[model samples]
Target: MSSLLKPFSISDGPCESGAFRHGVGCSKSLHSPAFDPTISHGATAPGCRTGTTRTRLGCTPGIYHTYSARRTLAAASTGGRKVTHPGKAILAGGIAGAIEICITFPTEYVKTQLQLDERANPPRYRGIGDCVKLTVQDHGYRGLYRGLSSLLYGSIPKSAVRFGTFEMLANPMRDETGRLDNTRSLWCGLGAGMAEAILVVCPMETLKVKFIHDQVSLAPRYRGFFHGVREIIRDQGVRGIYQGLTATVLKQGSNQAIRFYVMNSLRNWYKGDDPRGEMHPIVTAVFGATAGAASVFGNTPLDVVKTRMQGLEAHRYSNTVDCAFQILRNEGPVAFYKGTVPRLGRVCLDVAIVFVIYEEVVKLLNNVWLTD
Candidate 1:
């Protein structure tokens, strides 16, 4: 009779036999140092990438690292509890966002240029190459980054939603620090991508797209982020801010999904069998670069439509379909993906920075909170 009651008795007393009891200890451990699996397990040397924690793998290492990272986090993640690490995520997101915005602005400018056929003298731009040359000729090399001001305004919030939501959303799936698969990463990518699309992206992207594509402004060609917002609100009204929402949803959604999926996949594959924390940041960054390139290739077309739609006069196209058709008829197929290199660079940096920060911040939080 007592043997039948083993499961129920778990909550009645300490898990003296080292068995988890309804995972209460996982989060309960957060409040006390002794309960922490990570501290209890202890850290190994640099080469020991999760070598101490043995596990089987038919799955990628993102799962392994995610599972490993969760030792303390799982313990800390009791209902209504989380491993507080906002400061670290913020620092990482900020620095990475700034770098990504600066490096990618040129590509964004060129991409925007390709999509626009502003009804103007010489029809605005002959082609992407022509636009680049003209931009340099008229505004100097700096013209290639036409919307840096807006990018700065947009990048931080974009990154915050991406990284913050990724961390927050992925917290739901775990097997008491024992599961190993990239499931968490898939969810992270999906959640992060959706959060970014609906929130920060619709507006800043509209402004950047409008400013980059056309030399003229119905009101103002993004004089600044705030100025652009004011003009957009004053002239086109609030709904004017989301011109090609469907197209944007496709492009950025694919971008973020590819980014996290590939980034974590690489981390998992290279991490091999070892104690989890011993993974390499540089390797992860390189993987980010590759994943970013792949994502850009698939999603560039929708981005083109989104940009073109933003700069166009109302009724030019009711939605992304008309915008995409207009581009296909006018610019040919190649226009969809003109500024690939810069975007790849930007995405690579963004992914790397977010990963490092999230991981490092989580660790720092555990150390402080668990020790205190």
Candidate 2:
């Protein structure tokens, strides 16, 4: 009888030689008689606990195995971390945005200036270098960050909405192995982009462009961020701050879609089957820069239109469609890529910094926040 009762491994289950090896615990010892092999393998023993632990003493191997497999699947699917809460994502994204914008605002200023320079007879600045030179000559080097306050104010909420919405959308789309395929990643990014555009980006972007345009004007009217906002509202009404809703939505949607799709692809390729894989900061930067460059190429035309629509001279066009038509008709096709170079530099660095910071912050948060 003793020989017959010796522990034996169940090849198909988490239990090995009648011991709970997958972290599930049992109140009674596995070597006890409750685990008698003669009892039907599927039947519940008199002393066995219910739920996942039921199989600890071999009372229900089938159900416990299924539960264990599901746990394994979930861990893999989520990269062994809890799905980031919206609040945590918001904090991480905001930090990343603030840091990134500060570092890259000069390039942003140059890009906006080029985009707004519509004088065909004599372009305001020859190119990126000329734009920078002229800006420094006219307003000093600090001129390169003329409208940074508005952007800084908007960056926090813009990134918060972007990352929070992405996590919310992506949590459900991951496959059994916890991988987000390119198609699903693109959809998630698109959803996040649209969310940010509507929630925080449109008015913020409009204000930033107006500020930069005002700064360059012969007689700048706005005194500062608050004064400028109030004046804009007084003159153009609340609608002033939401000048380029359509173009912004299109640009931002495509921007994030391309960025996230590329980032996801690169990450998945790097990590292979290990969702929990950690990346070196350099590797993350490379992936982010690549993603940013892709987005810049994919949506620069839309960005040009968006900038024009939100600039101080927006009233020339009747609407978003008219705005695009006017640029195409008057400035020609090359005009659509007016600030591509400055934008490329800004966006690549911007994305690289943002991803590295955001990921690092998220990792720190995950360490402190316990998840089941």
Candidate 3:
């Protein structure tokens, strides 16, 4: 009995959780008792926790093994440590915004030109290349970046606010299972989009359209970024900076809602079990492109309305409704899809690049900050 109990006394680490099977097989000894040492010595399983039990019982030589519970990692925990830093979303979003504008501003310029061209008129340029060529011919190659300053000034904050809001909304709205479900993600995006639209996107888009559409001559009305902003405020008051608030809200809200929903779906599909699994950059880019494409198709009509409403000549229309009606009446339904090709190209590539850069920057920042 002493020898049989000796095996159970070995001090393994404390078992927080596990199943301990007590296999007591008594020997067929009518007069004497037989003890099994193997059964007395409990074997620990990976995730099993067994409480200490010292019983002086007689049993046959049966092997005893601990069955471990499946240990699941939390959603926020990564390979190194749990996520502790809250600024990661802002930093990542800001960096991605800056990079995206710099790389895709040219395409954006061309797309805007295509969208803003008056259908009733003979047309300012034949097509996308012609538009580009004419702009270069008239205002030089730098014309492609006519409104870059406005976007640069607003993009950082806009993206920061958008992503920050997304994180805030998503964390709280996550499902009971601690997973960010598609519906919650969509709501998160919608909230982020609306926040950004009201705070930064509306004004930035207004300025961008004013700069791009109102081409600058030697002595233009709106001289530069600051001057343009001042003129808009002076002429239209603070309201001028948010000329297309309604259209912008619709466009941005739908944009982010679709983007986040699709992106979340793709990411979850890729990382089936592990929510925090790190995907390759290429895979991230592909997912981002898919999301972007979906968003573009979903909101391009609203984007067109927004652009028209924010243009310098927006006063011609009373509001978003009037603008949409005018476009349908004057330019036909096809007008709603202006710049589809260029926009699709720019947006897909832009999203892919932005997400790749954003994820990489966040990872690097995590290393730099040693987030735990």
Candidate 4:
């Protein structure tokens, strides 16, 4: 009878074995460090042990704690919690952006060049390889990274705001069960996209597009990133910096909505109960690439409009509607997807790297600070 009652005693005190009632090895709890206050444990949560301990996968002893910390941060960021720590999100996103830009800016420059080219202007290069060969022939390999400085300036803050805002907004709209549904994920993404578009992407893209567009000219007026910025402000005024605000908003909003929705769907499908369950790094990268590709196809038309509106010859078009109409009428439908191949490659690789870095950085931060 006493043995029968032992299971009931777990809620109040240690069992007859005279050990603390936590985890599979109750005796180990008494000798371990003090309980971490920052971590919340569900006494009867699925897959969790007593107190704050969780069951480590593959029969490991201490790995559960590290995995639990990562899971908790992921959950909070992806709308499982009511709130998120913005500072950590910003830090993680900024570092991820800095890392991604250095590796991917050349592809971005090439994509921009391809998009801005036209057969009517006597096309400079036949295709992607020819473009690269001709660019190297005319301007050296360094020309592939002509507008990197502008991108770095924009991308850091743009990425920081994007992730930070998504985390902040996602939590509030979680379903009653505290799960992020596709609708909530999309809303969070759209809000983040719009925020970044208005604050950073517009001005930075203006400078970047102008710089890259003028790379074809023998006597380019915009010598550097700052010089271009000053000239735009001097001639077109500050409004010139926001040359493509409408198209940017549409493009970015749709881009993130598609990305987060698809990424979250993949995550939720893999981890039935917990959308933030840990996956192998390869799996995460694959999911990121898929989401990035989906976004590219969905919003490439808006991207075309944005590029035209922000170009040095932006005065040729009146607004987003006009830009789209002119492209359709003059450049034809194919022009809308002129840079699709380069963009698809750039975005897929960029998103994969950004997400993998962001998650790893967040995990590192969780290790450093108890509640971050």
Candidate 5:
């Protein structure tokens, strides 16, 4: 009988052993000395050992304590890592962008040249293969990177603004568990895209397009990045570098929204409920590539319009809507996807490289700087 009665003791109740069903009718009087009534409801009691059980219609003190400790640790770790630091994001993004542009500029050059080609009576190049052949033949292999300087100059700031803005916007959207949901991530991405477009991408893109177009022109005027920038400013003022602001914003905003939405969704799925989970670099690259492909398909039309608006012949089109209208009416709807193939390749590699580098850089920075 003493053995049977032993289980009813305050220190060895059914709650501690998880013997009670639904924790129903479990008396507070049977609670251990560690279970303080003065403690707030649903909070952990001091000195309680964690347990997978409930008591008095709520989680046992031990479970509450375990959960509380987990939350505290999560908060401390997150704070210590400074994951949302704008400066860190900017540095990482800039480094990633610089590296990515260097590796992928050839594809970017091809895409730009293709978009600028207006399907002349005698097309300058037959297709992707012909374009590459002619560029290499006429100007040597370096022609494949004709406008690299302009892109490199802009890529750093563009990516910096993008990631910095994203971290700033996303930090607030995270839940108590530090997880960012897909919808909020999409909005944050859009905001980051718009910010980067306005702050850096438009002028940089306009310069890049003009440089690439000039390279293929009968008389290539600009000698270098500075020279071209000066000439554009001398000829058209500051607006010359911002030729397609509206189109750029639209394209970039949609681009990031799609990429980040897909990326966040994939990450969430991969991580499940573990917000602090880390992914392998290869896995991150694959996810980034998928995200890039999604963005390319989703907004290639806007990208084409943006390219055209920033090209040498931009004056022919009045505005964003007019550019699209003319392309649809004269060039046919297919023209909207003119550089889809090259753009797809460049974007996939670019996104994958940028994300992988950015994540690794952030980790490095976290180790060096241990403050929020």
Candidate 6:
């Protein structure tokens, strides 16, 4: 009894979804014989399956006790109608991705350097500031973003697919399970991460690494993306490109679950401020910074493994476990967690950028979606 759901009443509205109401005992109409009106309606009556005329869906008199309690409300707002299911997610993703990239760019730049020069002096980049200064001093500001083109090539689409899938799948999955607990979030995150990893992420990531480590442009350097792709296939075989897929899955899956959980929880809490009441700029900034930092911190070890695994010279481990264990045995367990400082910086930047960007873009896309 203590664990039971406390009674909570949602404001009544004109429901229109084509769902059946139980016990409301059916429309004596022949078409929807199962249309019982006894149960509370989830939506308006379903459309005629065969274009049949409406049968009398009259309710029984005895069961239909009318409660005449009237209540006042401004309006039941679905928060600015949208054009498509993917629109909001895509907008959010774009915003998130843009922010993520900008904030994390420096950290990424350092990561690329570390991964490329595995044997470079100083081992991995020390602190975020040191890395930035070293990069600018040695390679120039351009060096700070050496692999940006490739990063964008993969990151944008990868993020779009990643978050879009998460949002879309989460919505439907929640509908199915009737809840959004951590389990649901995990599955949704897994599905989303896997989909993006295989499709958009793997190759783009490969390209980004190729650029960062090798200092080559995405295309032409090793042929084109396809040609480079072909070379990797010809030499290392198809599996080569997906070198760090498991690490990616680990990083992305966890990142997505935490990101979605935090963002959604916060959004729900703020729903009281309809018209998206403006939080203090500091609050937004802190949210963006903290979320990015949290995801980065949580997934840094995985990212390190993924980066090293992806950089696997010609012959490396055949599988994720092999690579992981090999690193642990040869380089020590700490090796698997290389680049923590940069990762911390990257995550902080990513979170701030993503949330702020996502919010702004959502607002814009909402306006646009509403118009169209």
Per-model TM-score versus the true fold: 0.67, 0.82, 0.78, 0.79, 0.81, 0.66
RMSD of 1: 14.2
lDDT of 4 by residue, 1-372 (tens): 777766332324544332444575454332222245444332434554543443333222232354446556766666544334677788889999988999998888888888888645888777788888888898899998899999998888988999999988887676644568887898889999999999988888988999898888778888888888888799989998999899999999999999999987887788787654578888889999999999999999899889989987789988899989988988899899988999999999999998888888877887686663
lDDT-better candidate, 3 vs 5: 5
List lDDT for all candidates, in order.
0.61, 0.85, 0.79, 0.80, 0.85, 0.59
Q: Report how far residue 369 has shifted in candidate 5, in Å.
A: 0.8
Q: Give the lowest summed-lDDT range of ten residues in model 5.
A: 27-36
Pairing residues by index, what is the TM-score of model 4?
A: 0.79
Sequence-dependent TM-score of model 2: 0.82
Off by more than 4 A, model 3: 1-85, 175-178, 216-219, 370-372
Residue pairs that clash (backbone atoms under 3 angstroms), model 4: none
Estimate, for each residue in 7-30, the C-alpha lDDT of model 1 and write its tens digit: 432234575432334445522221
lDDT of 2 by residue, 184-256 (tens): 9999999999999988999999999999999888899999999999999999898999999999999999999
What are the per-residue Cα lDDT tens digits for candidate 5 across 173-199? 787667889999999999999999999
Can you tell me which runs of candidate 4 are displaced by over 4 Å?
1-84, 175-178
User: So what's the TM-score on candidate 1?
Assistant: 0.67
The per-candidate count of clashes, in order, stands at 11, 1, 7, 0, 0, 19
RMSD of 5: 8.2
Order the candidates by TM-score, highest first — what do you get?
2, 5, 4, 3, 1, 6
Q: Which 10 consecutive residues of model 6 have the lowest summed lDDT?
A: 65-74
Best by TM-score: 2
Candidate 1 vs candidate 3: which has greater lDDT? 3
Which candidate, 1 or 6, has the higher lDDT? 1
> Total backbone clashes of model 6?
19
For model 4, the local distance difference test gives 0.80
